[model samples]
Target: MQWIENGDLSFLDNRGMNGFLEYEKAVREIIAKVRVNGDKALLSYTKQFDHVDLETLHADSEHIATAYRDLPGTFIEVIKEAAGNIRSFHEKQKPDSWDVTHADGSRLGQRVTPLDAVGVYVPGGTAAYPSSVLMGAIPALVAGVKRIVLVSPPQKNGEISDGVLAAANEIGIKEIYQVGGAQAIAALAYGTETIKPVDKIVGPGNIYVTAAKKEVFGTVAIDSLAGPSEIVILADDSANPDWLAADLLSQAEHDPLSMAILVTTSKSLGKAVESHIQKQVRSLPRAEIAKKSLDDFGKIILVEDYDDGIKTVNKLAPEHLEIVVTNPEQILPEVRHAGAIFIGAYSSEPVGDYFAGPNHIIPTNRTARYSSPLSVESFVKRSSIIQYSFEAMQNNGRKIAEFARYEGLEAHARAIEKRIQE
Candidate 1:
């Protein structure tokens, strides 16, 4: 990991813009083929990439039921617990349809409506992420989405992971398809013979999946162009190097492209954490990936002071920001950008990722600057409601017509005029 001192913001370029641009042409071509050819394109891509032959693209009810029976009781219990926490957190985020009336007998408010159907893409390759199932599906369920469809690649035996299916079953998601990659995204965006199109798609996936989501965005609503998982540790001298190293390694294990950064005012603390990382990473199962991630994308920046470190963290805008300082609460108010902020050493990133009430599907590659963690709001839409009585229309309709005419929209003005005249 590179160590930087002084104020240089260029190190904040974690997501290489050039790398994404290089793959854009290929991803766009895949999206275009999927859109034009539909199911044919999906089958071809699935066979070529996933090495799985499929006569039917959708998973049958029997397969889903079998998954439930196959999964262990302990795992099912854990899923239930996680689901409960996720549900509780998102329930609070659910916006209410509210209306307010003025004395002029005019009613104006907002109506919150859930999307008709939503598709969630779960990645299935090296790992089966049941946490993702809970994170993505619970929000849609809480938003009152009627149809929740899930799509994931099947193994050589033509079966989804038992844990994934169990999570889906727990959430009451019956419609699941045995598909993956950019092709699955395309199928979700444009309905196929077997798979139906959806109002929105959410979940994290590989670079190709992210690129495909970006390409098919206008055709169907998507959560965000999720990049690699990342975590930034803002530690002080008071932080334990062992705990800091463990937290950083936790995120790095997610992907070889994932980033783990440490910003500290104390040079000794930085070096101590670096040594600790070397020792701790040796025992991890995904140590190879974590090592590569740290070698390539990770950093240990030595800021001049705590304020400079905080400023650097804001500019980086990491997906998961951890404040392993003496007083985490004191510094939390200053953090302007971060998908989720973990305060103190006890509140590790994994806690938020799995058991915590907050959603873990966070914005990556500095997207936390503008984007937010997935919530119930992502599954619902709000429509502005307006009702005007005769008295109210007579009083304000002329002003409305004049404003519309000011914008050179004569038809809009005339429409309002006709309503008032009646």
Candidate 2:
């Protein structure tokens, strides 16, 4: 970690990975091939990219049953518990269709409707996140999406992860496909003989998968063009240096591009945390990856006070923000931007990543300043409900016509005027 005593927050800017556009041409070709050849292309891509020849593109109930039998009892129980927590949290985000009648005798409201179907692209290979399965699927289920499909790359033995299958089974996700990458995205956007098209796609993936989602965006809605994992910790002298080091390393080990930053008022604390990071990282299995991440993107800025620290954080708008101070509540309201806020030392970022009720899928690369974490709202669409009664139309139709005519939309004006009393 590079410690800057002067606190230059200008280095706070992160890399913008716009749905991994660098892979656009290749992703487009993959989509086109899937469109033309369907299941054949999926099989070919799976063999070519995943390095596995799949006999079938489906993970059946037998496969799920095997997953349960193979896994330990403790892991299975944990998955079940985590799924319950996720489901409970998202269920609260469900929006009811509301109606209101005004004095004009006109009904104006909003109707929330869940998408017909959704596809969750779970990344395989180096990143097999069963937690992402719960994070993505449970919200869709809460939104009342009728059909939820799971697509992930099969491993060397032509099977998805036992943990992944277990998570899906816990949530009652029926459609599980042994497909992934740009090809899986193509299969989801455009229907195949075995896998039907979906209304939206969610979950994180590599450059190719993200690029494929970008290309097929209008064809099907996507959660977001999420970038790499990241975290920012704002702490005072009250925070434990050892705990701080562990928290920063947690995100650093995720990817080479992942960032970990700390802003503090105590210069001595910064030095201590930096030392702890070095000591802790040596023992990590992904030490090389974490070392590279910390070497490149890790930072420690010593500010004069929390005000300057928070100002810098607002500009950064990190995916995860941890505020560890004497009184965390006093500092929280100043946080204008962040995907998720972890208040106090005890509130580690990883809690939300797995067992916690909040969704772990967050906006990265400063997007949290504008966007939000995935929720039940992402799975449902809202329609404006407008019903103008005869009396109401007579009273206000002229105003509506005038508003349209102001924009020089003659047809729009005439349409409203057609029902006017005058």
Top candidate (TM-score): 2
Instruction: Kindly provide the TM-score of model 2 when superposed on the true structure, using C-alpha atoms.
Output: 0.96
- Per-residue CA lDDT of model 1 for 263-302, tens digit only, reads 9988999999999999999999999999999998888989
What would the per-residue lDDT of candidate 2 be over residues 111-170, giving only the tens digit for each residue? 999999999988886556899899999999899999999999988777898889988888
How big is the positional error of residue 290 in model 1, measured in Å on the Cα after superposition? 1.1
RMSD per model, one decimal: 1.8, 1.5
In candidate 1, which residue ranges exceed 4 Å CA deviation?
14-18, 419-422
What would the TM-scores of all predictions be?
A: 0.95, 0.96
Look at candidate 2 and tell me the lDDT of residue 359: 96
After TM-score superposition, the amount by which residue 196's alpha carbon in candidate 2 deviates from its true location, in angstroms, is: 0.9
Residue 163 lDDT, candidate 1, scale 0-100:
78
